[model samples]
Target: MKRKMAMSKVPGYLVEVDHWNNEKEHTVLLAENSLLICKYDFVMLRCERIQRIPLNCIDRICHGEFTFPQKSLNKREGEGLRIIWDRLREPTFLSRWNPFSGDFPFCTFTKHPVLEANDKFTKMCALDQFMDQLTQAVQRAHEKKPIPGNANRVPVLKHPILIETYVGLMSFIGNQNKLGFCLARGNMGF
Candidate 1:
């Protein structure tokens, strides 16, 4: 049998694909801010993992830094960064299995899963650099809505449930799409 070759769009520029093949894990590349494209082969075994995320959909990134109180002789501390998508929907079963409903931690950006598992100091540096690059890219990509100075001129409704119910009913009758129904929910319920 033969093996297929994998290559990035740009050889030495725009895209820089990374490869890590060890006893612990294997990944062909970590492209953009939200994908871990993996490729591996062993004798008769072959596998590839692909995760494509739309960066425009990300709402923000969180950098968590904290320390735990010392129950022993020394205090334990850890730091990490996470990618917070504006929408909860994800393509993979791995992500779908662990939904980020604000109640749970978002898709982590810290220590590339493969690196974190190795427990090396390089993990910290890698995560820090990744966070910085991701943050910059997100800021540049995300567009902010400008608030009108006279925004207060518009009337504010005290009761919004009536409007919400009306939309929901209309969507039900019209058989609206997922996005339409989502809006009708008013709070993105489920």
Candidate 2:
């Protein structure tokens, strides 16, 4: 039952945090809430919480690696990327709200589940799609293309994935004075 739930949704651009207990090791996956966008040179994690961190705030981005210490001579099981943010940037997440506990400094997916050999192909496909989306979003921001229109009507670059059209235009935004083209990519419910 737990494996079924874990395999249902794949974390897109996630950071793996290591937790060790004696002979066993655990990997916690941190899920990103939304698109990684650079707004005015600030590489912002526009999560549901809306935290902003400058590009320089990132200490390093290690890809295809895991920093967890191994317990035995056996080969390591998981390998993924991690982003080290500058401590000074205060990247803490609200751990608890009732009593307002200490800052978590990061967010992670709760369940630590392992993938079986048969499930590897599907997981890899999902991971590839996640990476592609992150890459495209970051690349678009870095290119510094004008964001199409004004605040009311945002001009999104013409991308097949981002743009959607139906019987009527479902990707446009406008105000009384101005209009903008906005692309609601993932959520395109008619």
Which residue pairs in candidate 2 have backbone atoms (N, alpha carbon, C) closer than 3 angstroms, thus clashing?
A: 148-155, 149-155, 153-180
RMSD of each: 18.8, 21.0
For candidate 2, lDDT tens digit of each residue in 1-190?
3332112143332222222101111222222322332111112223223343332223333335333323322222344433333334552333232112324332221112333234653463343344444344434343443232312121222211100112111111221111211223344310
Give the Cα RMSD of candidate 2: 21.0
After the best TM-score superposition of candidate 2, give how far the Cα of residue 157 lies from its true spot, in angstroms: 27
- Give TM per candidate: 0.36, 0.30
Top candidate by lDDT:
1
Q: Which ranges of candidate 1 are over 4 A from the true structure?
A: 1-47, 66-77, 87-105, 112-125, 143-190
The positional error of residue 66 in candidate 1, measured at the CA in angstroms, is 6.9
- Please provide the root mean square deviation of candidate 1 (C-alpha atoms, Å): 18.8
lDDT string, candidate 1, 81-156, tens digits:
4454533454454433332222322343223333444445344336556555555544433433222332211121
